[model samples]
Target chain A: MIRAALFATAALALPTHAAAQETPNMPAATSPSPGVWIPRMQARAYLLENDQTLLEQDLRIEHGLARDLSMWAELPLYEGFLDAPRPSDGEFGLGALEAGIELRVLQHDLDAIDTVRGAVFAGAALPTATDGFGRQSLDPFVGAAITAIFGRHGVNAAARYTFVTGDTDLPLFIGDDGEDVIGADLGYAFRLAPAAYGEERVAAWYLTLELNGAFTAEGDREVLFAPGLLVEAPTYAVELGVQLPIAQEGSDRPEIDLGIFAGLRLLY
Target chain B: MRHPILIGACLCAAHLLAPSCTSTASTPTAVTMSYSAEPLAAGEHELEVHGMSCPKCVSNVDLQLKRLPGVDAAVVDMKRGVVTITLSGNARPSARDLATAVSDAGFTLRAIDRGAQGGTP
Candidate 1:
């Protein structure tokens, strides 16, 4: 399923849309504080087998509707090779449009420097891609995320499942079988700069590590290990990371050899 | 695939149906009405804010407080969860106003203590 891989590559950009004070490659239970609006952009390149490469640029926006409610929308543009075997030069077009809402279910402020939060989110992707680059059907998904922060160390985890409603005709290992998809991710962040907080408004630096896994209904599975660095200020953030395949099994498409991403975020 | 979706849906439904479970325990009650009618004197005021754990969180509080008219400066001590605000001369922001700003920033104002006029706490 070259189409599946294309969509999956776009989906990988979703985690970079995290709210304020979150790692770059994982879903965090935290949202923008109430009345805040965040705009984000990310560029990603995936190096696949057969000398093929997929490039994606994603633009997203997030808004805090209330103390416990937040929403986000994302649109991606893709340009690169789709057929691993054929290895044509490439095509460029828009990908699916995705939107989701998150509701914080549990939040506990243990103290001034420690807190824990949990949230559940649901959303759907509209088949808005240019011809031959998308699933061409509405796909619904659901997920849960958690965040725990203890001083300079933070942990975030999330899991999601998407219902694939499109049709795939390519043979197994080269194309998707139209089966649903499941994904799970875990991330850790350590503040590397500004050993302590003070009165001045100083930019903070963070080192992050994430483990991302995806599985298809037909047993195709892939896991990636990503490490990143982030610099965050009061109203903006910059981040960059690299992803390497740690394990892959029962895949039905071209394997990803490497992925690199860079992103920026601004809050208003 | 279907199983995971079903479980996630059920969990979402369970959480949505239970408002109490989703509410934060430290959500501040309506205490603004208890604030004195008199505006805080022109001076530095120390406020103990809750639910701030990161630099961005601190910045949120800082920005909201500085948005209030008459606030000369807002200094934060993150480790102590304290924000010291200095009011300019002729500035007459009420306690309720300060509390509302903090609330709007998604934090709780646990307590406020006024310092000497025109001086740091």
Candidate 2:
């Protein structure tokens, strides 16, 4: 009876937030809070292509909406690495931006836990990444994810589906200019090294190594992998790494697209 | 940074078949187009370059290679301990310099197979 009441309250309070399909990135439904700290903002980018030499860039921002949930938007910036008089040298345009949220279903710090830790997430992403960048029109999507940390080992898995409704532009990656969008992210992170966290003057410091591989539901049937290190402090963290595009997906041109990037993730 | 929540779901299907992925006993799976067990080659050595054990090491290696002259695109086959280079216009590599680059990036140059004889650019 209480669960039904809670559902009713949620339905009336947040109707649009309800996801059509559950993605691993999206956690189970939950309430919202201002968060232990203020919401944070992050910027990250990626350069991708096939062996054919095609190119694409991704610029994105992610922010936490609550303690266990964070919202994000991504824009597939700068494509056409092969275009023109150095087409690769061009201005920044609208990249595919997605407005979605991620929830942390489970959170625990166990001393004897080794590396066994599991957390779940799921949310909705409105195709806000941008229609101008050849991205799809306004569409709604959903996804879910579960990740665990065991000993020095870390593992995660997730899936998502984007339903097609409004105008259709057949987004890139997918072979068709169709009416739907599908995406998934899976990988792992190992705490190869550990650093300190928080101080009297600061929150903390943390250092660790990681590895990850991901593919999407669209034309990108690729097994993209990256390994790198991260330095985390109380207020923020920095991650440096590169992408190795060893696999190709769909009609996506095949080219050796490589990139070196740094990212800022803060919990402000 | 946080361990990406996406990786687990993406490789879940495969992990079911190869549960030994992170174990010392784990064997490198089919990573090359030719599908060879002893995949590492000479010009480049990739002997299960352990120690990294994370996604970031993959990125670090890519960064280390781009700085090389002859190396056009250095694609690291993470799960396979292989690094494939797309050389440009007869870009020759000095084994000593190549080894240093790999070592500085924090990995072992198990082997380098001049990459496939022919595949698109």
Candidate 3:
């Protein structure tokens, strides 16, 4: 689950998540290099627009379907929104469910060419997390991005626009669908520790700057900005960071939200 | 000022320019081995140290030992949890240096076996 606090999303704000931690989340749907394939459990907390926050933990399975493809399925083990009305007194309800796939179109080994390969990616976010917290019936989004790598530096720029049916059976919640969403990211990573044994893992530490904006199909606009960090090891990795909303328009929602995310993947 | 394109471009430029400053010449790794100041006997020594977990760990230990001023090569079979370091010419790393490198890598060297010692070969 993309936890609320981890992503720093406000309760009332739209979904403006952080950088592409996954290669599927990589530069794009093109040429991706062989990266670490990690499987583990993760948890994150989201700060919504209403000053309310929701934290979720999930058993997540993220597999690098291919150099340019990643498949992930997350099942919620628990969920709690700090500011939103509690769904129940105890942990008994269908939580927001989600599953998705990310595709990379281009990428290359910077080590060989010394030039980081560029890439593009397209993917969809499914409404798989249960509707317990804020999971709507359907949330289908499409996005594209490009990434460039320098020796120990790089940037991944992505734009994602999700078209929601604006049809959550629930009324108070307006799904992000119909809200043309766009996210652009800039990130850099340096090798804190060089891979001397086995094969070299890509960059060791990565920091990302991300900005996302959404203009409703109806001409309403809202934007969000987020940044985060990541550390990679041979068979495992650790990451931590926060997201803050920078600009907002055409909405009654607050202009800012906050969240935190962290996880590691074991490369096969 | 959200200039990912500009930022990406600059980064691409830096990545391209960095190697030029270092010298178009690739770093040449010299494969010459020298024995340490102190030479070891043809036999073995029982030495206790740290840092040896998996096969990869063994590789690092081997890399460290083989570069010994006097030692020639080292082999670590992680499954067996043993490392065999051998040298022919002269110069040998002090037991302290060997133990330190192993410990720094997060492993312990329980013993060093030459032929006479009973440690794992």
Candidate 4:
């Protein structure tokens, strides 16, 4: 059952929830390259009650290199507390550097309805962390994502699989929860503001919900439901969300009672 | 420990300062003047779109429309929420196809006006 879910998500290849589209009434998880450069800094913190805290600061840049192709790079600083009972043994270091390219696969327009968009992407994560905080070796991943919009409602789906290459015998870290990992997310976004469109730079708000899951080859699976609010201006956006674990099984990984994500994105 | 803080500070400063440096280009006066009233070429169609609230939304529309198989060019008018699409030689898409592309980009197709040059038969 875990493998099946993994495969299903791997096939979808959805975009990260942090990369919402700038357009109103669009899905928040599908990355859209609007023929321009987009630079985003995302700060994420995860807290496990009585367990650990994970802090991530990522510098991400994406550009539409061509009409149908876009490339992106992400540099992250990760700070997290592992399973150590001592309070001071937590680790902080540069996390994996990731780079990827996405190709628009399908885009179609309906006569009286909204449009549909699809894309496929492939990327690699390079080990750059200290003290086993990241995958100690290079990890490659590929996935597909699709989005559909209808007036003020939109839905997005994505699946991806990462081929892990880390020292399995090393001491475990919170980031080392898996060997091969499959991840997927299903999200819906509803426009909350801007009952009517405007000509100048418009500020729109959206209420979003996402079902996200990660499946590991080691039989560990973690699933969460996240509800968020997104605000978009002309060239920037701010998003805030909370993730609550719905199901967790297998592996000794401690369940996160609650997690929060706040992000800011900019386009140029 | 200080890296995240430093970066955050710098980003915050940039975000606050960018408006002063680049506000003129996106001003309402500038946006209204950008509406294209140019004539469409043969096999061209114009889509009066809805719900495109910003320049980024216009870009999204352009990106998705140009991804269609037969499309050669897509121009989005942010001022009017209009998109002009041109088809390649001997290629065409139905109204449904156009609507689907716009919808996929998270916009509505309010109207499709055939180009004055000629319609695809």
Better of 2 and 4 by TM-score: 4
lDDT by residue for model 1 over A181-243, one digit each (tens)? 788999998988788777677778889899998887677788999999988876667788999
For each candidate, report its DockQ versus the true two-chain complex. 0.44, 0.01, 0.02, 0.06
Instruction: Report the TM-score for the A-chain of model 4.
Output: 0.80
Model 1 chain A weakest lDDT span, ten residues long: A167-176
The runs of at least 3 residues in candidate 1 whose Cα sits more than 4 Å from the true structure, single-residue gaps closed, are A1-21, A84-87, A170-176, B1-12, B15-17, B29-39, B88-97, B114-121
Q: Looking at candidate 2, what is the lDDT of residue A177?
A: 41
lDDT of 3 by residue, A1-268 (tens): 3543333332212211122232212233222112323344545556666565556555545554543456655555445443324433323234444466655433332221123223333344455544444445454444556555444444556665444533333222224333434444444443333322223223345555555555555555655555666655434455566656565555333234665655554332
Best first by lDDT, ranked: 1, 4, 3, 2
Runs of candidate 3 exceeding 4 Å displacement: A1-42, A49-51, A58-60, A64-70, A74-78, A82-103, A110-129, A169-180, A190-203, A219-222, A249-256, A264-268, B1-121
TM-score of chain A of each: 0.85, 0.59, 0.64, 0.80
Error of 4 at A227 (Å): 0.4
Q: Model 2, stretches more than 4 Å misplaced?
A: A1-33, A36-81, A84-89, A112-132, A164-176, A179-182, A195-220, A252-256, A266-268, B1-121
What does candidate 3's lDDT look like per residue over B1-121, in tens digits?
A: 3234434554575457445523321111010112132345644444333323222333345544555576666655432345556655545666555654443332345445634543332
Candidate 4 per-residue lDDT, tens place, A96-122, comes to 788988766554444232556666677
Angstrom error at residue B5, model 2: 26
Give lDDT tens digits, candidate 1, residues B1-121. 6646676766777666567643453244354445555678888788877768666777788878888888999988887888988997676688888877876676667668834354211
Tens-digit per-residue lDDT, A74-147, candidate 2: 54444333433323433334544566665444333222222222223333334453432444445455555554
Candidate 2 chain A: 10-residue stretch with minimal lDDT: A15-24
By lDDT, is 2 or 3 better? 3
In order of appearance, the predictions have TM-scores of: 0.82, 0.45, 0.50, 0.65
The candidate, 1 or 4, that scores higher on DockQ is 1
Candidate 4 regions exceeding 4 Å error are: A1-35, A49-51, A81-91, A111-113, A168-178, A198-201, B1-55, B59-80, B83-121
